[model samples]
Target: MMMVGKPVYGIAKSRSAFAQAMKSQAPQQTLDDLFAAVARQVPEFGGMFLGDNEETLQVYLSVVSPTKVVAVQKAIVAVFGTSVIPKGGVKALQGQYGFLQLKDWYDRMTGPILRVSGVTFTDIAEGRNHLAIGIGKPEVESRVIEQLQKLAIPRESVVIEVSGPIETLTHTVRMPNSMSPWPYLRAGGYILTRLLCNQTGVGISQATLGFNIIGPSLGAGFVTASHATAAWWKLDTIAGFPPADFYQASGYYPPHLVGRETVDPHGFTGGACPTGLICRYSDSAFVRYNSNVKFGVGHIARTTGITTSVTSPILTIDHGGSPSGEFLIVAAPSVPYLTGLTLNKVGHYTGWTQGKIQMTNANFSQIPSAYIQVGCPGGLADPTMPPAGATLLSQYVVGDPTNDVVHSGDSGSPVFRSLKGLALRRAELYGIVWARFAGTYKQFIFSPIGGVPFQPTGVKTDLPPFRYCDASASPPC
Candidate 1:
């Protein structure tokens, strides 16, 4: 079944019922309106998520009063009707702080908390209705708690756990079969850029193409990880490497031109990024295709016989398979909360893999020395290093306990959810994969597609508008 909306609770009896519930609006829009209504009715709305059984919507509030509980119940019934509500109705729980307040604390404390040695990531756990911090060293937990206490942040409002360092997912291998020879470009296809690696000693760097995007006035282009271009900064000392050129198969002699690097903001000094931190809304970059190049709008490549080993030399990409093998991108939703939603991605190295979202609105940072050691070149005193801090904001953390959900060379891979019940091989585009945590193959991170910075504010997926038609509608409808 295809579950839609944030905290998508309960199950639809049929496809038509689901469509009617959503009406003409996208699932996300409908849910957003409902949540907004609840927030308006209840001033102390903390957050919401699905119950453990996935049957009831669990709403949390700073103060769980009878009047507020009734308001939340009314909001749910008004938006989704009584049938959608569970037998127990909408359950309200008492929380230590409101969601907005926690978010404010999250934003204010991310830099300071990350500055603590061994801290790996920080996020707001909506289900728990509090802030969650992950540290690489268990011994550092007390120090982190002390920092929070110094800020007057309630000890009961936060949870700390031991974790591993998060690292970029750029692969360096000599896989001749990873290249795409097809005339039309598609998402998940292999893309290589040798400009940055020539001096770093990391040979033949490769990444997966995300998806096709177009601006009303900017024509067409494709998106990938900005780091994949190896041009993170404007002052690249490497001669003839200012703007990295991307190739379809290989950058060797008779290179197949895919596109030219266009929009990639190195780092912003202030705003959502904090003054001293090298921060980016998304770890993505735009690549404008050549004039004569042809591309698929929302098509994503499918492969079979994927290798299980993370260090494997090659992935068995099946390009000549039937149309059923391809996944059609039907919709793009800004998933607000992703605690337990199942999502999947296809990459050049890992092929097709699926995992559940563990956290959202998460922040992760890498020290300048660690980043530089892994192919990037910027010393602590260099312009690339942020004097204050370096962190990524609003990232999705996904994991699969038993397997490696993502690997090197998987950066820029399209992350999406399967909507097979609605239409065969149909899916919704969610975000793009960028990095994974070290010492564990179980987790990786992605940035939402809507976060990609493009000019004119009209840039979006090239796919046609998605709509649901009645059974009696006209053939074209």
Candidate 2:
């Protein structure tokens, strides 16, 4: 979890005032220390969040015993001092189970629950202090409940909702003309690859380039969705198959060779995964760009004219290499994973959009055969039984009821939150858009940058020059 200052609730009349208020609050370390003290003192501590009023620190407890509540209150007082404990006092609420317990139950019950037909996703709802299971069909709710009962999981500790199917957001055809012909490549720009699937013939695939990164040994590269590459299913199967080449703007044309896939770990069973479940931390792939291509670190393409058709133009509003039109990534701080925190994303197809985080640490189910056929065709044989599917862990789910937050060709888009007080046109990097729920325009999912496997030592930015120090080098260069 990221360190945060005092919670800001409701609408802020002035960004400067909001920043000043955050600056005046007690250091984030104090809250962290208080949380640690409470966790050590109260074993039933469920979780913590900012109260609706913004001043109170709302703590949840499984049992909510008088002694535990008093201990938590005392800890808060000791940390913040009785006289200056914000405006609203700390409050302890009754919860069904502790956060850790709910996480454990989530790991244990995901396979069984997903085995039931029509199940879509599962999440550890830290804010609500319960486990949530999503199903596509309402009739399967009883079966899901029965599965939970069989595992001895309390019904009250879990919530089942109809969420429909989850599908990847990679588009098979060329996207609208939002491509940037700028001298440098940047985040939120377009990337393309050609695929010749055995099942589906030749086609061009498009997805958003996530961000620019650099490592001590890997040099400079960018990240994107693994499934958007050509012959992705053969990554782990075929030997000596050529690495897929990526293009920008135009396909099979000059000045289009940008990079090639380098690091993409295939899914596997066992080793930290629950029994019978295939596991992977991210649906991301790292691409090492060519030396000739200039990469603009922290720069996100400013786009406009959003449309759902292939013929319509989605124009890149910024031109002539001006920084004013782009969103500058000031920091890549860890997210607090709090529900209702507003986040924004810039995709090649969707342009820029905003939504609130609905769930954190969400796990989405993928049928084993379908997953392998699409991204790992020549791997292990298909399983004949249920509960033997793939589960993607540690994902953020965002939704906006009034608008479509994501769409086809938006995979690998940069997901972030604006930092209004820090600077104009500045934001913090959070995650990368990967998939969206089918039949719904509101819900989409992203993989947190911190959890992305093989991520760079640090995210590169334009303002501050990023330096990579190798611990193994002589004199720790």
Candidate 3:
């Protein structure tokens, strides 16, 4: 959770003042901490939202049984002075739940059932009351439903989705690196920016570097689809071959594929883990920035040759690169996961596109072996699944029925909150783009940065630069 300053008692001395602060949106972290504190104090905390006037922070507690709603409000008032209207009783609290708490309960209850063959992924709904499970094979739906019934999940709150067959989503045929012919050379090294191409020369298809991130232990590292590196790692380790390089356009000859290193998949011998060199999760990989190679950070491109920087918490409204000159400020991790929000991604094939988050806490098991072996390498699987604990979420953008929200080369693009008008310095990194539904518009599967398990072998720090967006959005300063 994002750390918040001490609540100001004087400012909220009056309920009207408190409402005014909320109206300003008062920074997402402030609101998040308030809700988190209340939920933590009361296990039965259900859900919270702004009242019709948009000033009152309305809270609801579980009405499974009678609740002291007024007493709870008084207690909260004594501490924060924030205006709240507590609603109780079964009727009022129907379908309400504490998202984090309920998700934890579901995870605890369904561990064994998750390992079933057809169970691809599972996640608590954004609303906290609903649960969704991705079923790979339709035939196993009955058994899954029976298992859930035994576990006591309400039938109406559960949604079973079909995510297609058991095949791995890895696209193995490598494409030509798509750098411009006349690449810019800076400071005696090839300086590449957005749209400069990259790849592992093996059978894997070429992909574009999405953006770069900075952390304490490392320099800027390029980010991309995890499958690109995973596919190469298998070949690199078993066949003793080298991975591909990042490239700028070479004027005379074919663009030189500069020698790039494989950080995650870090090689199959060591399944991808969070290292200063490479952090892999969400079907995405981070490649250490080699000063010798000289690649710049930030700057994403659209199909129309326009570009924007990722350094700020912002997103351009137009997808085709025709600059709308309008940018949507990003929200912090305090408000990390939400459905029905617009999201954007940049990739080697599909330049840029937008979509909405269809679900949260999505579960997936039928993934490439690389993810299964994460943080363990040659050892037995880690037992923890790729997205099981808060590390991932899924989204589907219904485009014009022609363009995909994301494509194979687009993996590793950051999925961020857009158009909320929240204030911030740079684009908030929400989750890493990984896989997509085959033959459908469900183009991206994302892993939240917060829930990733850092292996003891790599850089021991949380994901860098954006670590604040991790588990609770509050990282040690």
* lDDT scores of the candidates, listed in order: 0.59, 0.58, 0.40
| Ranking of models by TM-score | 1, 2, 3
Which residue pairs clash within candidate 1?
171-409
Task: Please write out the lDDT profile of model 1 over residues 1-477, one tens digit for every residue.
Answer: 011113221122333443332222221221223444556666687766655443667788888889888876775555445555555557788876665677667767777887887787777777677778888767889999989988888888787876666677874122333444554443444555544433434445677787766644445777787667654522233323444666666444223656776665555545555545666546776777788667666667665543345665235545454443466665544233335566788777777777777776676664433664233443311113323465766677777667677787788888877765733466666778888877776677887553444111232321212221212222211
Query: lDDT tens digits, residues 441-476, model 2?
Result: 676788765445322123221111221111221211
User: What are the per-model C-alpha RMSD values against the true structure?
Assistant: 7.0, 8.8, 10.7
Candidate order by decreasing lDDT: 1, 2, 3
Instruction: Give lDDT: candidate 1, residue 155.
Output: 82
- Top lDDT: which candidate number? 1
Task: Please give the RMSD of candidate 2 to the true structure.
Answer: 8.8
Which candidate leads in TM-score? 1
Candidate 1's C-alpha runs over 4 A off are 1-40, 43-45, 51-56, 61-70, 76-101, 172-184, 189-193, 197-202, 233-240, 250-255, 305-324, 334-336, 366-369, 372-388, 454-477
TM-score for candidate 1, residues paired by index = 0.74
Q: What are the TM-scores, per candidate, against the unseen true structure?
A: 0.74, 0.72, 0.58
Q: What is the lDDT of candidate 2?
A: 0.58
**TM-score: the better of candidates 1 and 3:** 1
